[model samples]
Target: MAALSGLAVTGGTIAACTGKAKPQVQGKLLGPSFKAGHLLRKGINVVPTETEEQEVVIVGGGASGLAAARWLKKHSDKNILLLELENETGGNSAAGKNEQTAYPWGAHYLPLPNNSFTELLDFLQETNVITGYDAKGLPIYNEYYLCFDPEERLYINNYWQEGLVPRWGVPENDLQQIERFQQLTEELKQAKGIDGKYAFDIPVDHSSADAQYRDLDQLTMLEWLQQHELTSEYLHWYVDYACRDDFGSALAHTSAWAGIHYFASRKAEASNSEPHRILTWPEGNNWLVQRLRESCTDRIRTNAMVYRVGEQDGKVAVDYMDLRTQKYKRILAEQCIMATPQFVNQRLLSALPELLSTRNLQSFEYVPWLVANLTLKDVPHGKGLSLCWDNVIYGSKSLGYVYANHQQVALFPEKKTITFYHALADEAPAAARGKAYGSSYEDWKAVVLQELEKAHPGIQEQVEQLDVWVWGHGMIYPKPGFIWSEDRQQAGAPYQNKLYFAHTDLSGISVFEEAFYRGITAARQLLNTERA
Candidate 1:
């Protein structure tokens, strides 16, 4: 196989190898291949047959799988099958709609893309989100998608304040510490390792492996902050909010490397706005997912839960159960891309030949989240900052909420809707999920209303309808050593140059950038094999 050297593969002559259709073989017995057969025998029934062929079978129809499918279709003429467990393709980026407006269920926001994120930028351009470039060659993002004015407000000391960082009624010393921290992060953004990799980069894999920087992965963010004498309660709260907002983990639970990366990894230079600006739609990331879905709608199969995967007779076979039909179907493919999370993939590939032990794969943990969308007659305004795109409360366990109607600049008269997103920061995700699931709709509504009532008393009266969603395993939490661990690195590597893994889990931190990069990486690997 030819070595894959570039980010994009434009065109290729790849074709599926033709073969006669084989009858469905059902049994628990191992196939001809001893290793693969033995591995299948240990797992649940429904192993792959040796005599079947498919061009490619992609598991999970999330951003990663969709990205891979887009790349495969654009680059080569190969038969590809994309399987998704849900009825939708967006995964956590899924959206919900009411009579008033559409809202996000899980992931609701995305930061602006850095210039180094060429693939992402190109995709945005293709989608018309990047309308054109300025004279200086920076991207001028679409005005409609760029987050509107009055971006964020935080409720603190019984007053709503402008911006996320605590500025109102804060001690001068703590303010100085916050300034120092931002300045240091700015320096780190420009810093480069001896190996020429950025000290901090999106997708994280692009970061420099230099020991000077990699050593940071060994310590917790809390430890690093304390070591730097940044012990102010306000400063700590802000940092913890940022961590939970993106990584779904608190400062003490996150790695110093991941924490600093959140601040320094952003190097986005745009023609219209500063590097810190972000692009968002009313429905959040669902807008981007719609663009991805446009690439290969015909090939995607939703509600197709993949159960088993294995290689047999130099080909890969994926056995899946159709949730709607309750029928089992097997897809024979030359290659397979597992874009599901590590935990789900572990179940599917448990039957695969020479697969890793389950114990090793179980080391990773995911955090849960509760997102509530409320239709309101009006949002009670406080004295200081007005309702904005992001509304947060200072010193609160919850990450406040976002107003979905904010992007619809055209003002409405009677009613407005706001989605309150709560990241369960303190408790274990499993416990939180259990609590959330056991609770009724009214109970969940009470939970959300109570949290809101803390900041806005009697605000529940303005609410017309409240809907709640619980993501049991919302995102992978980057514990101290997870990102730089050898185990995670090995798990992400392709198996036998045919089975590739792509997911936010592989990146050890779940973000849109990581999911996009994961898909591109897996697609590039498969393209290389075809070229070879």
Candidate 2:
């Protein structure tokens, strides 16, 4: 069996290390309302006690679903209903709060947006994230929301480095390779194709169709690096880290286009702080989700598990289970937007799989993730560097942890929370997801501590509370040939002009911006159909 990264251990070694159990920690496991959705898999046969008619029904209250609801409410007075299986609306963007502070469950930050995204900027402006515009027409971001100084650091070579990219103790040759790769990415960032479109653009669908650059989509990021003779181990580690951080996949599994896109896609104009600095809060994206939820509060319904979606009597029928009532409910709508991931969509529309070809659904593969929020009385100070907002341990399978209170304005605090993230990119998606779902909190705690102890010896003693959340289908990985495939292009197609699909999966990259875009696009399509 292949040894895990950083640990350099076979499967047997892992068992040996974790065989001895320690004192139980003082926290519980929390996650999405999987039970509500899992009930559908057993086959829901309950008859609906109530039938309602809606102008539009949006399934899945993630970013896409919320965005669709907001757009529809703003454009038309038509009654719209948005349903979410989880108790909370913000899918992966969900957050939890304790007395000390609020921490993220999944997604944690949003980079500065390009001015081209007028709609997104408008939403930000409405939410007070973009306070005003400067003399140069640059967006003025609120200082409170911008990430604090001492933003990122990396633990490398038994010492904490100042930045995420390895600079300390790296050999001259490896350093040069890393610099050369940066130069290449910088050039690509400014590169434009013959059609006057960026070689790599966010929302990926807007990227240049010029085959000269689009052809790269057919190759793995690792293959692309090898072809460029940029094979430094340090560089490989850095690139793989970026892939895992953004797409939750390694270089070998990620598409070259998506890999390059991660670095070059952002072309945000110079802002009040920095050109492309990220904006984040203690609650992560849930802060944004709250603003979106406020726009259409009456239209949103949580704890509603959608089981089947089919067309009947010239309208789409959305059958869902009301978890509170333990009974089925039905919504007949003129138009429907499925904001759920393709995996869930496949099952919901299983009876109508021909509409969304099963072959297209097979093309998408989701990566699993483990996020743990450790409440600590005080974190053990590492050797050379203090706690930064984002701290990454070099060569570890787990991406270290983020200081959740890094953005807090309070001058003094006795307690703190650190959110740790790990992407199981080395294993097959299905196998990793199954193993993660089957494991208990103790099993995960062992895995997390084993990785953290490498950077912080005896750190577990400082932990007061450790809450773990597993994302069975965290996000889609843009594997080679999958990004530009015909199936992906057809995945977003509306069925009979009555059913529209909107989800980050349709964009081939899972990001807040992509999900928002898909939702708004689907909503606009519905409006246009109504007008026609």
Candidate 3:
């Protein structure tokens, strides 16, 4: 396990499903149908039969796009049209429902927000997550929405511990090393640079630009740990696990700045909740996305794929294929906010290549992820911590699973669903994505079962159904030097202040807060330009 630390798996083939399993167990594979979106790559030559003029057009329906639409709706009465390629507007934060409960496809929780994110707090208040402000001026969060007790647990050394950190059966020296690392992170959490700003901030762009801190981006997290002379097998596993959990990369693959930011960047404050406390729902972040969706529902168009983005008559013109009508549609707007991934932008904005000068598009490598939602007859009871909201298996390649219905207000659940997560970090992005796309439902089912069986022996018998979803381009990998690179910085720049970019990828971290920040920020930028 120690030897595998800081190493990636890179493009290993999934073994064919051969063994026999319980006859009651059945499963299916699900994900975004790439056929419509990929057709854009081949260049769509659809002529617009209809044209719609809007003051602002937002492309993509993810968190960023939704946030942009919501902000624009509240700030301006501009004619806005938001388009989404998928059947739904939630993007990766999409969810599904069964007779039992609701479950998430991607993001699941929002950490107690940083106090500086006043807009986010306001959003929370609108959603009732933040009920009101206290006498101390701290926000009062809804207790029901907060994660319940036994928040997390880890299966390590043949036992389940209280938390994800490997504490049980660890040697004294290793325990001390873990403590030291924790103390360092705690210190760095409040540590500010000479610029009078937090060394690491949640939005990432807001972090200090001090040379002392920015230099960390040049080296790998492993190198940084070694420089500090902190070498414990347990610590390595913890750090490597954290890097993979958040950035979808190993210590060696993750930038030192990104790795540390994972620990120090979040300092959420509230009157009743601690910094570690987070807000979640049965359907994960889809709850938040739904709130954003409601704010600008009339402007959002699903089953609409934007294929061409061009400048016409000193305005941004978007050409899209309407999946419902099977007709080409065009939207000419005074301003545009592109909330799609950088890769999609590369092709969509091919007409204006010079506008996107970020030449190292290859540097924006993404990691493929496998998520399995299993419906079980009953929750599996392991030796340690019964099933917590978030569960982990120490030294395992997978990030373990989470109880999809953990936030249920019901007294007890006889049957439940678990959402399993795995980042294919061992292989290169391209090769891994190819392999993931080529793999079969049986292949993924076999892989998921193999990992889960480690912690829950004979658990397959209890699984009534399993659904697998593969994210070909799951999340951005902040490899060493990529986070602070010039290409990344330029990638976020607004083109002529007419077209803007917004996505969690711009921050190199795929989290709800960053995506929200990118969306609201882009919308505000467009508003400022209109005023200017």
Candidate 4:
């Protein structure tokens, strides 16, 4: 165990007198002196105590964890505890602030919500994103935080253009295909099963399980596109980009069901806002995380790395190491929520006495991501529209980046910063993670700078600092038949009434909406169990 290193005091240090020389010590001293053998005590832990237990134990404090915590607290009277491996609660939704602007390390944006997503809209309303409902019950979104003008720009053929869809210099045949594809999506949006469930829905579980649609999940997006005669290169490129941006995989690897669902799932409308307008902040999803943390901070323990979970005396026992203390501790709860990704859950469940076979879990593949936040004096201007919410360079493997300061209407004259986001979707996650782990800070910086130099010449001179964040298992890809497989469904299902699963991976499409809804579903299920 690591030795504790500081003294605890209720007030300040006291003053000592020697030969008319005064040494002042202030405040009320509570504990022992610190000179080497002292045990460090902080917060509410100054008094040593035994292990604690709660009714519900939630692991992983990222967006999903925090969301689960919030929902559980709101709906239950039972004692609850949330354990986070990291010191902070946001997880991948974490954000940082430089001297210039606040930037996101991972997820940076959320598209507009469909009207059917009442729960998410309610949360937004509580957060003031939706100020009020109009006379006709239409939600009025906050004007300030709605994504600013010039939403997206693409650089192709050395010319900066507007919008992400390939329009500039697009061939006539490709344009027609793009239109046809949009028409097909519109048709799917209205599709329903014999059970009356939408063919595609927000919380994917709510979708129609009709074999006609479910069978689509068995095929790759590439195959479906080819079968539909959507063979335009421009159309194919746009589809690929959409899949990579949201699912973190290419069309060839994504499921036909997930790919089509991405387009058809959105059925949003607002009185004051456009259906396509999204609510975003300078810190991205971290903004939502702050709200989620408000109701559960007292119940959360950070930097607690859980290693094992199993049944003990008819209760769920969680064994975790306190990173700060370097000591292992155990907590027993009635139920557990495994809010981590499938990969991490596999390791934890492996230690259980009656471990479920992991054959199905192993099929899910996660992709890695590299996000670079650059502090710059100024961004070089391009030929067309100025910096937008989502910017990209056509044909570039990178997702380009967003101007972190774009949402901040209060403009500064000089010394601006921009976050350059590059998702290395081409490399397998295992290879990417290995390479990213071995890369030095300088090496990662070079990779980001080189990519930026393509769009902005002499950008190196303007850049004051560059920070790189690598996500080893950023998101689970819908990989070909994986989405529609029996394995995925089984992996996501609750096990033995003791363990529950929740993550974006269960939806077969990793996105903010899916992650949010996943947490809600798990929490609701747990609540229902307790009620019964």
lDDT tens digits by residue: candidate 1, 90-135: 8888888777678887777778898888899999999998998888
Candidate 3 lDDT by residue in tens digits, 1-532: 1112122222121222324535455878999867885797688877687987888899999999999999999998888889999989887788887788999888888899889988899999999999999998999999999999879999998888998788999999999988988898889888888999999997888898888998999999999889988899889989989998887788777899999999999988789988788888889999999999998888789999899999888989899988998889888899999999988888888889788554556568899888899999876687877889999988888889989879997757778999998887877778777778877777677677777877887777788999999988889989888878888888888889889888889988888999999999899999899899
Positional deviation of residue 186's Cα in model 4 after best superposition, in angstroms: 2.2
lDDT per residue for candidate 2 within 416-529, as digits (tens), equals 899999888888888777777877776677677777777886666677888899988999979988888888878888788898989999988888999899999999988888
What lDDT is obtained when candidate 4 is compared to the true structure?
Answer: 0.74
Q: How many clashing pairs per prediction, in order?
A: 4, 0, 6, 11
Please, what is the whole-model Cα lDDT of each candidate in the order they appear? Answer: 0.78, 0.85, 0.85, 0.74
Cα lDDT tens digits, model 4, 246-317, are 877777877889899888988877887778777788888888888989988899998777766777788887
| Candidate rank order under TM-score | 2, 3, 1, 4
Q: What TM-score does candidate 1 get on C-alpha atoms?
A: 0.89
TM-score of each: 0.89, 0.95, 0.95, 0.88
The residue ranges of model 1 lying beyond 4 angstroms of the native Cα positions read 1-53
Give the C-alpha lDDT of model 3. Answer: 0.85
